[model samples]
Target: MAGTPTIFLHAELLPNIRQLTLHVSLPNSASEIDIRESTITLSESCRAVTVFTLHQDVELVETLKLPVKVTDASRRNLSFAGHRVDIGGTESKAQTAEYSFRLQVDPNDAGLTFTNKGFQEDDYVPWTASDMSTCAALHCKFCKQMIVDVASKPDTSSWQWKDLPSGNWAEMMDFWHCHKPDVHPDDKEGQKDIEAQNASVKGYGASNRVVATPRTGLVDVASFLVAESDCQNIKVLEQRPTSTSAKPASHDGKNARNIGCSGCSAIIGTEDSVAEGLRLYKNNIVVKHTGATEHVYETHSIDIITSSRFLDLIDHEGVRRFVIHAGQSNGILLWAFNPDLRYSSSSADHSIVSRRAMKVLYQNATDVERILEPENGVPTPLSLEELFLPENIYDELVLSLRRSNLLMPISARIFREWNVALLDRIEKRP
Candidate 1:
């Protein structure tokens, strides 16, 4: 019997863009592959088939198919032996070309929703150029860092803002009641602040309490600004504590610290004082309201801003754990198992139950088993093939981490370690 070809198909969700990536890996030589000649077709069954002719000189052809829809697609060849493609139209020695297809799913699809409270909904209001100008020149009061600027208006048409719900008195009261109970000892001042905010809300509603609204292309937590250095024009300042609204503590503590603009000693936002993991605040951020009679500027908490460092990985028990340290703030930890990959089984496994377990752990050949056992030599770098997680799961992991001010871009060193591990696994295979 002819054994199955060493072809692998995998799908991953792009966390930043909320797009689906379908990748096909072929075991054929690069000189025999020409993605430009490939044709991909999608079926009503939500499956896709790709046919490409390889080694045109010999008229050799191959077909690769998977269960997915191809929307926007592109192709690139990669060689594990450190081969680079020349841009000057020079043919180079490469062995593998990876074909990536972006899937087409409705923006209103149920799969995109995060929570019942509509936290991750796509209901964003466009931000006009004038609307962004209000806070363009403003800096943090404590750090004097330039938070926003006129040049920030890259896409005035699609850029939008969304209102984040501020918890009611009951929620706020409960948070303060439990936060640092030993330190507060007595809830007298905490109770007073809750009552005061509640009274203000009751009289003026949430409008009065909302101060500033920041705009982003998306409404996810990571969409907000995280690092003071991300701002082109900014000044750093000596760290200092800044006062904030007496709201119930969310993931971070009650007081926000270390989130000041570098350009000036202005307190733009609040951050965790210790790890400085994630910072949250609304200082000098405002949006414009176009009225029928005249232009009106108001402080609204419709949009919030934040900053944090890159992601970090730790080993717990036998499983590899991933987390984002929000500097001095609390870190955001991810769940052990990915829900999407839970039902998948490894095709290489002969036993049905073991195959099912493989699907649950690795999803497909494209899925890389998170560093289950770290090897001693040079750490392998992680690739897109290894971390191709589902969109919903990936988004939640990133959003939660960002909200806690712990979200960060994966670093190159970590990727190197993942790649090294991957090569070792491939070499060890009999």
Candidate 2:
């Protein structure tokens, strides 16, 4: 409805029949186009014309003919979403008059073949956890220890302060949620002071919906990772006490200690006596090279690592060079390569020479140049070829690219073209 309504036609060839389906998008007001009044005619023995009048004045007509003979024709008016028709090939009963269209086709006597162009080869398909596991291992960036086996227990969870309450009990719940000192008073005098302060507040003694309920597992909780029990492997690098008067309460109603990786001294998460478990922050931990290890904590669901996680996997050396290209739907295409190890070599290595040269091209090319430049100044774009890469590297790159929302829609052909362009540039530089 936003733009000119475009109709798409699909044709399939069977042994003795050629099936043609027409998908039409009509304006919201133009419902139920009388197919009986519409006209379909064959011209030049290969072209077909469909004409219908809507709103008594607006005439919708299409003219195209294929090499086929007319045997029978049928039309049906149905209500459906515009997107369903865009996807094509799906059959659904009419429910509403939001979207209306018609279909017309005839039997083939000229023996012309029919093919469906609705589906593309390069359409995006999501990667499974197993696909990702095959490319890289989940390990701690600092110690390089197997922190998580994503293939087995792919799920992660998190916890956060619950929403503040309202009414007389609002102040009390706020104090607890914020870990206020009065909520964890040390003496009867402090408790009495809090009670006396709220005494003037109406409905202070009345019970309301705001109440603390104990929950297990990560359902409806913040993102968290079940850390290994060996606290020795991880150190409490820094501690921010939420309670100024006293230590914060843990699961056991005792003091809590924020913890971190002992190896890298990076703030990883918190240790609460009340929770009696090491809760790792989802953002703090790194996932690197894969290895086989058993999970330290129980899991309910598998958390599929997504494109945003690619940043965490980058190492100290970082990427050799990177570029961003404007993509469809206002997205961005990110191209990055790992730092070249061949640069450290003394002699002139062909692989290293090619890699360095490719890096120069990437660093120097403008966004448009990167995507449109010809290989060796040839007319064809550099991406219109096959790319050669190590299996592991290719898989890793594909996974990251597919997961990233920044990239444009990836069809198999587009992915191959992009991959080839990048790899070919690198491999052919020397």
Candidate 3:
């Protein structure tokens, strides 16, 4: 028997174009391999692609299976047009070579009977206020200390969990909720005062300000905005600004400080200087809901939590490109290419289970101002939002991006100046 060949395969189906693209990496020289002698087979019965290489030392055959049947974006079954696949290009480096191939596909004939639909979306729900029980207790994930003890209250029903508006709520309000001020034309001072009042009210308005009130835990997309008095076993430490870093500022334009778990001394979140509350990060703490058979906690990595928030921001703000700054020197330029994609890799152990991912084009941006110029024939001015992230969260996100970059073949790693990678959005939590 021939030994298994060291090969890696990545396949992407483009239903819109009726094409399937494949990238195959093998530990051999391109000159030694005869592309004409190799053959590819697409079996609808098994929903897999089998590749045969006859030019190698020993005949090698490998099959890449799909979790779901091949289907178009609209769930219509797609059949292979022909078994012949065209090699687009090949790149050889050192002792390894990567081959790119494209195959044509067509929609199934209406007369033919087919009973395979593509796999549905994952069976996990994104975090929201409804997912949290009224009597939930928030505890530090590191130390397991109860930070917000709402379950201990006699009447938990009184406490409300109100979801805050999206990060770009102020911009949306300017377009949808704008109204002319009612002030006399003669008094300019009165008009100015009225305009200021309309732009920002005490706790709500057109400014990017979300206020937290008593007895209410304001929920953002990724964190909880709770009153400082409601938090226990936590300490606030002053964050001094450095030369390369700007002074830490909260959403409400006040000097911000670090909020840490007193028991473990882990930085959980930041203090809300304006609202006088603790913005507890969801990934840093665990929540115990009411009426559970066992102690169930939903925990996520910083990258996963950050990616979910990015999805929300895209849905609400409709902005795909963003400049995220951790400090004056550390920054990342993110252009979300595809928010949803289904992919499978031969390198993974569970290749049968296709994963959901977000395709992104990223670049390390030390000087954000320099990269803001137009590139790739962008007609209109670029619309980018500056995101000020905590240093720890920024580091995690960068690490996640780099780790995923290694999973791709060298040819697909970079797109011009941006590095191409996929961020897996696997959600198993109910």
Candidate 4:
């Protein structure tokens, strides 16, 4: 629709209400095309839709077929209605026509049944909860260099893998210990002394401190925190102060450094000085399980890993807004519209039976330094979680967001400065 001479179809089935929302984008304006004669064929086995348009210069026909097979109970219950076709866009050069309709199931169909295989709770495994046996070996995805061999640890008898409670574990501890309700308001000096004494005795209120034990690997939503003595073939870059980070300091106090793969010099994670260990990103390393055969290793893409992190953030913090900063001038303002949804697109792969995804509204914040400042333009200070990512990972996230637009209808791809897209949820294997 956006100057391309191709058709795009997007379909979203709302199984809860037994309805399907459909959108079809055309290459020409509404005046130049006609769809009164178009046809849709629906059966228990498949769905086929055909569009025929006649213009003064040319005549075109296109068809979209969905490979979904339904039960016989739904064969006689589904229908399409409430059709709307019109032109969309602000400028003439970008204007295009789109057709939209809803396929509904009859309210009287009591015997109707739907397949819900991929939408189960267990399928949405968080990255922090991902399976990792004590015997597994961590390898760099880029160079295949072994970073940590769990079976070879000096204390194999005590070796274990444990997941952190949440991504904001340290922040929560700091808030609880520093802002205790029982502290007296009159004695400020006494409060400070009591807090310091409690911290020293219990060692439970240290901020930004993630210490990894000699025989345990601490797992968080994004990275694995492990002792430095157990790592190999990795390099830690010189620490430098971050210019655009709005979040808390890294493990290295006020400075942060990239942890790189020794073979390819590619960034795999960051150095955590507080933990005296390496925070290896999950997406950059492959995991060879204890009983893996044929040398197969489980690897996750950067986008999938990021999406899981978003879900984990939403779960723990109960917030959906995030500001991802790459540098001084560029960043992304992201809102998780719907944390989980079942979606299907005609332009996507037909082989897949079900797709679990998250709908997101993202905007490219050019003036990132002032985007959230109340004095600049924003009305008030926003409670946004901040992520300071390296340049390469930031680019990959932006690319993944933009590339997802191709799998959606043109009319629903954008809204003002915010671009609408979907980040797929990682499906766990049995």
Candidate 5:
């Protein structure tokens, strides 16, 4: 019994009841004090959750948002007005908790609503793949500007993200869960290397668990991924026992968790210190970020086009957009393939295409985040033509190459020599 409390309620009302309300009885007698805790304690992390979506047997265009009705016990209602999930350029006009989600169509007068209740309150989503992780781009630790603002350098101090083990995606996921750098349940595998490989597969770029954004995505899912250049962080949460665990458990029925002496609930934030491992946030999820040990800018072996393969598998509907290092391999990779580029083939010998990434581009992307692609944003591809074909292409190439961790310029002749040597490699490749 910790000083703080968490109670959950689920119920169904008959057609006759116009409204349903929930009331929770706490040990505290002061009303103002208790109310403040709800605001500070339960962050606005709770959004709408749904078991189903619009179009029962139709092609899916976008992931529909379904609002959730949350309240305490005693069946009292909450006064959270202005409720709706924004969809396809339109916001639901309803202020009710459980509203029917409908794609814009005439037959959908009934809109969207969930009556059967698919998941209970204390379901305990304990993995990076948990449903809540993809709530919105704001949830991703690396992508969201507020967490790791574009201007703020990458969490260089965060553990150097070791590339996940080489294995199938499923195996990588399993490995991530078992060998999470921090809290993790003791699986039957007993901390084996194979388990770590599996977790890395599923856990890569996942929101609940943080990793590097530039390399986020199931890259090796394609056979084209002959080798990996993956690098990012991992965390495993420690588990507590019914009565045998040494760490204090959470008072909220969810999971008996540890509590601070002053009584702030445990939350993982972006302060970059203890924030690296854990913190005490109410609703928001923080993916523990350890800086990468490897320099991602290192000139990678051109053995396999792993970057191009990643762009191919992006579920553009479920995603918002990508934040990549300017002129890095990812941009070059996307230009080489991405079907949406209006190009016929990746290897078609044509003009060099690339997205010129500015330091400000990433630094400015604090609020823009998406799991698939930015709903209102477009994928920015800094092309090579912008920096590599004109009057002073060499000068621009020098900077770009330097950024790519290629040859550094020592003198005019030295730069020309390095330039000739590099172009020679590309020209002879075919």
Candidate 6:
């Protein structure tokens, strides 16, 4: 019989890896390989681990200690096959143990409801069960790293994916609530602001409170939906606190002196630091919740904005130098990260999009647009269409052709590439 092979996080660095743990397994094969991190490349045929030779490998009788390694520079989050890992530093206050999130399975498709809400965080709304569409919002972290898949499904080493557990389906609910600003008769101040923004929108008059995407930022889907109707909330990635530990250390002692912000990694109690972490916040929308605490952003408020405030925060008061966007089937993925985050959140309707797809689009778009551009990294959007899918994703003509499976990889890959190319072109246009 094949050896009971497994992997472990031997070392995080090529030279040194720390924090080792073993969690649950995947659903399909019971391959006890724990899928930590949300970031990874999606290959329909990629397997979760190279050691997962069979589905039964996941159902190991003893706690399997496979030597799993994190291959990307992005943060490594915690997640399993169909389930997300449940871990947090905000709540735990652990120093270096938060390596990833951990959890079991409970896929009732039971939509997330607001309980412990924060700014721009929301759950199921009894009010718009029919009018608005909802998603599971699963992912503890937002790193869009990936592992290999499908063609060599048994050995998933090549596929890349988002590995950070910044936001899972459930946490995503919180994220959605924070950014997707809610507006109703209840939120008077918020309503007033949205009303004013709504008025300034030219041509697209009906668009609601979506403040014009900052000169550098693109309008998020949640914001766009609000522009269309009473958007439940909008999720944006702005800067926030990372920890309440050691006061930020100073590299120059002048500006970095005693710098402590919300998401600081080593923030000392009352002491300040220059580092920070991400948090969810809201723009418009009247959020009213029944339960929770009283942080600037309530844990259980009716208003929610699925946003990443950490993006607004920079390293020890660092400034956001990049404001890029990626188009997705359902919406646009805004990439806004500061130096502190070390890892970044790849925005998407689903958890991630394939790197190969991004690469293919990068290669092809150069010909169609007659422009010479960098192809190594994902294309960043500078315009609205560039940020989100322009044509109805399902209706794109290019995708329709690949649906028959002629293009290598798969249809999913083709569509993802097209989205990347389309956004690149639209963003580059004046």
Q: Kindly list the per-residue Cα lDDT of model 1 for residues 259-293, writing each as its tens digit.
A: 44455544344443332233333324333333312
What TM-score would candidate 2 get against the native?
0.22
Q: TM-score each candidate.
A: 0.26, 0.22, 0.73, 0.75, 0.17, 0.17
Residues 1-430 of candidate 4: C-alpha lDDT, one tens digit per residue: 5333655666665556566566766665656655553434454344545555554455555555432333345433322233445435567524456667666644443323332332334434444434775347889888888888887845457567887765566677878766867755789889788778877776555543557877678888778988878888989765444455244236545455788889988788877776777788887888887778746888876667888878877777776888887654668999987665656565635333546677899997766656666454557545577777776677888888988865677767777778898887786555
lDDT computed for candidate 3: 0.65
Q: Which stretches of candidate 3 lie over 4 Å from their true place?
A: 1-5, 15-18, 31-39, 52-62, 71-92, 104-125, 142-144, 155-159, 174-210, 213-215, 243-247, 289-296, 349-351, 369-381, 426-430
| Candidate 5 lDDT, 1-430, residue by residue in tens | 6433222111112111222211122122222222322311111322221121122122112111112223222121232222222222223212112211111111221211222211121111122223222212112222322222211234543211122233345455656657858535675456566645654674553333432233232112111110112211212234423222111222223332221212122222211121122222212222332242322211212111122222222331222123322222122111221111111101123222211111111111222123123355766433221111111222333344334322211111122212211110111101
Please list the residue runs of candidate 4 whose C-alpha ends up more than 4 Å from where it truly belongs after superposition: 1-7, 14-18, 26-37, 45-84, 87-97, 105-130, 153-155, 170-210, 238-249, 291-295, 348-350, 376-378
Candidate 1 TM-score over all chains jointly? 0.26
* Candidate 2 residue-wise lDDT, 1-430, digit = tens: 5453322222112222243333333333324555345444444443443434353444656443432333434323222323233212223223112222333335344332322111122111122222233323334444545443433433443212232221124556555546845444458688776666674463344343322222211211112324344234566544442322212324455444656555665545566443344654433444332353444321111111221122222221233233332121111233443211111111111121111101111222223343444458667543221121212222444444443212211111133324411221111111
* Per-model CA lDDT versus the true structure: 0.32, 0.32, 0.65, 0.67, 0.23, 0.23
Candidate 6 lDDT, 361-394, residue by residue in tens = 2212212121113255757333211211112221
Q: Indicate the residue-level lDDT of 145 in model 1.
A: 41
By TM-score, the best candidate is 4
- Span of ten consecutive residues with least summed lDDT in model 3: 110-119
Compare the candidates by lDDT and give the number of the best one. 4
Candidate 3 lDDT tens digits, 1-430: 9555566778765444555566776556656666566666667553566666654666766678643344333122222223223323554444556666555444563211111112133322245666664446888888788788776566654677877766666566676445745556688798678657866664345444666665678877678999887788999765746424433446557557779888987777888766667798887888877774456766666656766766776776677888877655557889988766556777764356566667889998766544554457666445675676776667778888898888887778888889988876645533
Model 5 TM-score (2 dp): 0.17
* lDDT, model 6, position 53: 23
Clashes of each: 59, 28, 0, 0, 77, 150
RMSD of each candidate?
23.0, 23.5, 7.0, 6.3, 28.7, 24.0
